[model samples]
Target: MDEVARAFLLPSALIWCLAGWFAASRRGLSSSPVFAGCWLLALAGNLSLILAAELLVFYFGFALMTFAAYGLVVHQGSPQALNAGRWYLFMMFLGELCLFTAVALLAVAAGAATALGLASYHGLTLGLFAVGFAIKLGLVGVHTWLPRAHPVAPVPASAVLSGVMIKTGILGWWRVSEPHGPLLSDWGPWLMFLGIVTVFYGIASGLNSREPKTVLAWSSVSQMGLAALLAGLALTSPGAGHLAWLGIAWLVLHHGLAKAALFLGAGLFQDSQGKARGWIGLLLCLPALALAGAPFTSGWFAKAALDAAVIEAGQGAWLPWLLTAGAVGTTLLMARFLHSLWVTPEADGLPTRGPWLPWGFSIVCVLALPWTAWVPEHVRDMANGPLALLSALWPVVLGLALYMALFTRPATAIRWPWRPRAFGPRAAIPALLPGLVHVERRMHRWSVVGTLFMFVIALLLAALSLRISGPVA
Candidate 1:
């Protein structure tokens, strides 16, 4: 696990450094001291997670990272940034409460704060950890903070927030919970169920959003769902759980780097002019397609591992098929992101060197990472297999087909290779925008969010109860 964390940490550090540079280069933000402070804070958070040997060490790291991200989110100090920061901080503190309690409970039960010691406790403690971490994972119902925060934050901040910060939740779970030894709780199926919900819901929400960053934010929600599914499957199958945990780690690394590339690329695309616009668009699509788990990409490699783990676990027939379907949503989301990028006006000035270096590095990393020696031989083999390649190809094909069919209107007279226009006249902006925003606003209210937090806790308790009670007599 530490090995896997190290692999993840390396790219994260590189990206974080790039993020600070990018933030510093932004026009109005150049003089702000928060960028450097937040960068260090984020750095400290990353180190704490990577080097943590004890539960307290890991939790402190997680907390530092979480709060430090708050500074980045509110860097702009606009109404939107302030609002997003408020919601983000609120959710962060609430999640911290759940996390602190769960960690303390594990420490008390096991008499030590090490992962090995904490694993001895029953699944109920795992459940607490899940509730706490799921906030960061942006798992359904509790995921409102993500879309709000990611879009409003500056590009560099958004990059790290989505790419690196979010994965800490899964890392926290890896540190404190044992999925491979014994099932502490029966939350595996529930985790899977919620994950599936998050996948579809994220697509739905993204389709409705106008901001390109918001669309990407929702896409993160969906990808995190895939990670959660991997985690859930791991928890349920002692035989395959270790393999599944590897898949989880790989998935986060794969998603983080690729998503960071796309976010940074989106910013670049927005800022490019003339030929640079077309070139940046092409660059942007590479990571976007990579994100769809297209063949030969890192997503393909990581997803193959996940598929193998699921099969090895004997989870069910439907899950793999459903996961394939998820690729379709991702395709649509990426397509929308691209289209949004296309229509937006390019920035007037020449592109900055700051984002280019890291963005290019990220793209290079995305393409090259899977082929490195560190990847397992089996994963490499699977990624190269004809059957796996074809399976990966189909979803992207289907998603493109679906995008053309849904977004374009059929010409009155059909011709050979009939081309369709992009987007329905009515579908240009989501019809549900006002309502979704309104709901999110209400959720931001202290009274309402407080209730929602309690509701999440109640749901956690109920899930634990159902697991403990088994079938009613």
Candidate 2:
């Protein structure tokens, strides 16, 4: 866990500084007082995490980062930016409340001991912790904020938010649900279910998206799902859970760098031209492939560790296949993102200037990490094996085939069945704004949201009681 904190803090510091530089230059916030304030608050937030040794300290760090990010999101001050920031804050507060309540209950349950004590409260605390972090992770049902906030925020802020901040939520879950002395076996399956749902939902949403950043946002949603799956697997199998932590940590590190690179690269690609654009496109594939868990990359290595943990735990055979399918979906989404970058026309008269050094550094990190000691022993051993290689290869192959079939060809246009209009392949996916925005609007209502939070707490308590008691018979 200390290693996880260190891993995150290093990147948080790097990206936070870079993001501030980029936001000032890219978003024209150089003269704005708000930018300075957000920068300070965000720095304090990261410091809190680094200095934290206990629950309250961690919560304070989490809260500072959460609210500070709102300023980053709304820096543009446009209606869309404001709306996205509003939703971001709404979910942020809700998640904080859930985490605070759970931590408070946990401290009380420990009696004289602090929140770090290896004691388990019934399912209530575990459930609250899971849901709270899931909100931050942007897991399927609660993920409305992520896609909105990511696209609306300036490039660097989106990079850091996707890269570093979200991982804090995963860290919280690890501390709360995983450990030696206490077991929360019943909570495991529920988390696994959420992971599965989030994986597919993110892919589907990414496929449906038109904006490059929004597509990347949905990719984070999917990748975080993979993280949740591993965490849940660990919860069910405590012995292997410790080993699984290696996989989780690897995922966070590799994904954070690669995803950050891709987001930053997306910003660069927008205004690039001719030879420069071609070069950027080629560079883009490195992070995209890394993200897809291609063989020999950090993603594949981390995924191998996760797979080994799941197999060691004797989880059902279905999981390995599902994980592979999730990989295929991820590949498809990355393919779409790359395609969008390739085809979309540059903005009218937008300056060609971009932060090339940061993007390049990110690319370097993505390539360098996997080949080093970061690749877990289990992955290192099997990475070259024929079956293991094939398992990784097949998904990318299928994604490429599907991409060629659906997107590259001109004659393969399909009819739109759901909408009143008959549309071509280009128009296959309808705008997601209407339905998703409508749902977010209702969720933003203070009274209704407050009621929902209380209901979630009560429901978790009732379920915890039921689990604690024996069967009625």
**Residues 208-264, model 2: lDDT tens digits:** 777889899999999999888887778777777876777888888888888888888
Runs of candidate 1 with Cα error greater than 4 angstroms are 24-30, 108-124, 348-354, 408-448, 456-473
Where does candidate 1 have its weakest 10-residue lDDT segment? 464-473
Would you give me the overall lDDT of model 1? 0.77
Models 1 onward score TM values of 0.87, 0.87
Per model, state how many residue pairs clash.
Answer: 1, 0
Cα lDDT of model 1 by residue, 1-473, tens digit? 45756866876777787666666666656777767788688879877777787778888988998999898899878999999898899888878877776676556655666563334444455656777799998988788899999888888889888988888887776765553346433767777788888887788778767688998999999999988887777767778787888888778778888888888888777877888789888888888988888988888887788888988999789888898889987988888788777889867667554357767877888888777876777677667768888999999999888766555445223342433333442243244233554565566577887897787678556544542322111
Local accuracy by lDDT, each model:
0.77, 0.76
List where candidate 2 sits over 4 angstroms from the true fold.
10-14, 17-27, 107-120, 180-182, 411-454, 457-473
